[model samples]
Target: MTKIAVLGAGSWGTALANTMAKNEQDVTIWSHKAEQAKEIALKKTNARYLPGASLDSNLKATDDMALAVQGADIVLLVVPTKAIRQVAKQLGTILEEKRQQVVLAHAAKGLEQKTHLRISQMIEAEIPAEFVTGLAVISGPSHAEDVVKGDLTAISIGSTDDAAARLLQAALANEHFRPYTNSDLVGSELGGALKNIIAIGSGMLIGKGYGANAQAALLTRGLVEIREVGKALGAEGETFLGLAGIGDLIVTGMSPNSRNYRAGVALASGKPLAQVEEEMGMVIEGVNTIKAVVDFEEEFDLDLPITRTLYQVIYEGKTIDQGINDLMTRPLKAED
Candidate 1:
């Protein structure tokens, strides 16, 4: 049996931990809070984030980091992006002290707050190579809520190392869950991160009572912008056309299950960005991603109309209508 340690008790972590348990894989969920970990261990339910879902009785949860990482064969980092490096650093220490080489896979789907580096890149930078045998990332259209409820979900694993990706694929694949592997790290990471930004924009459109036509237009154009940006980052254009690219985008941008989309709705309803995030009690990745996009766009001298407009709205206090006007009235250019 493969022993997997999932760090974090967030919705994604709880749902996936349960799924792994259902698959009869030995899974342990670690939380920073003792109460949260205790609650999961006793109740088999995470009410705060993943309400109304039953977790497997065999699944284990704890607040002790050492217990989670010590004998783990696979350490799944499911914490927020901001917490990733901190956890990885701590993990590195334990792995070295105890002398364990584990495969590291991540479900976190945003760039580093400061460097704009992908989650895998951040992990690589923090974790010692001797402690890590391989690295992989999991991302796609699957929502945490739906996955726990046994809705059919298809997701992708991306890695430069194919053997590592296949390991995760074989362990994760089952009747309700499907996994595909891709060798393009850039495409998978960009697809997952950039979709959150576009999803927020799509949510803003919905909150403002814009029709489906406008929302559809935003999604299509957003893909174009993302494709260009991804290419500049060394991702292939064809990658954007695949499941990691367009498939993830459609679900995240259009689904109410997406936190980024819900955060956009809150923003459209006149909630301050800070207030919205605090109330959600979750990392609104799109909000952070917008800041990263603004920073990186200047570095690359790229024109990402949708991302830039969302940035102006979120960071500069521009109104939704104003942002839309700027987007719709940009100087006419032929579709590339």
Candidate 2:
């Protein structure tokens, strides 16, 4: 059996461990909290993150990074984007000497806030270059809750290294959770990061009781903004139209399980952003991604109207009504 190390014990992390465990892989999950590791090991469940979901016996949970990664063929990072660098730094200290052919897989979906670096870039910066055989991002319309229930889902595994990408496709693909491979790392990462911002807008519209036509308009406009930003960042244009872009956007925008969409709904209902985050009890990545998008817009001088409106609402304390009015009053243009 292939030995895999999964870092982090959050919902997505635990869900991934569950998936691999069910597939009969020898999976070791590293958790920062010893109690959480004990919970997974003793109870065969991660009740906090993956409530009511039982993990397979093949899955082992540990607090020691060295033990978790020892002899692993691949390291699957499911930590938050903000935590990527810190975790990678810690891994570097422990695994610097390991010469095993290890493929690094990440399920993180946001860019670094100030640097605008993708998670893979952050990992490369923290770890020795030669130790990283390849980097792959697995993303698409995946919700942790639904995935744990074995719902049919499809996701993309993207990497610049073709051989590594194929290896990931083979490792992760299954009857219920199908995986497709892509080589456009920029497009894949950008699509995953930017969609969260749009999901917030979608949730806000739904919370305000907007009709389907209005939701459709927001979704379409959101895609344009994502594409513009992706292009500015050197991503291939057509990649945004694929599973990572349109597929992720549609699912996150419409699904109640999406933390970003939920945050948007809370914002629309007149709740403060801070309070909404507290209520959600999970990281709303869109909030941080909004900041990153604003920074990117300013840096590239790109006109991201929707993202600008979102920034105003999130940071400037602008009312949703004002934000929506500002968006509607903007000069119109032909659909590209």
Residues 138-162 of candidate 2: C-alpha lDDT, one tens digit per residue? 8888988888889998999889998
Count clashing residue pairs in model 2: 0
The local distance difference test score of model 2 is: 0.88
List clashing residue pairs in candidate 2: none
- In model 2, which regions exceed 4 Å deviation? none
Q: Relative to the true structure, how large is the alpha-carbon lDDT of every model?
A: 0.89, 0.88
Off by over 4 Å in 1: none
TM per prediction: 0.97, 0.97
- lDDT accuracy of residue 245 in candidate 2: 91
C-alpha RMSD for every candidate: 1.2, 1.2
lDDT tens string, model 1, 132-189?
8889888888899999999999999888888888877877888999999999888888
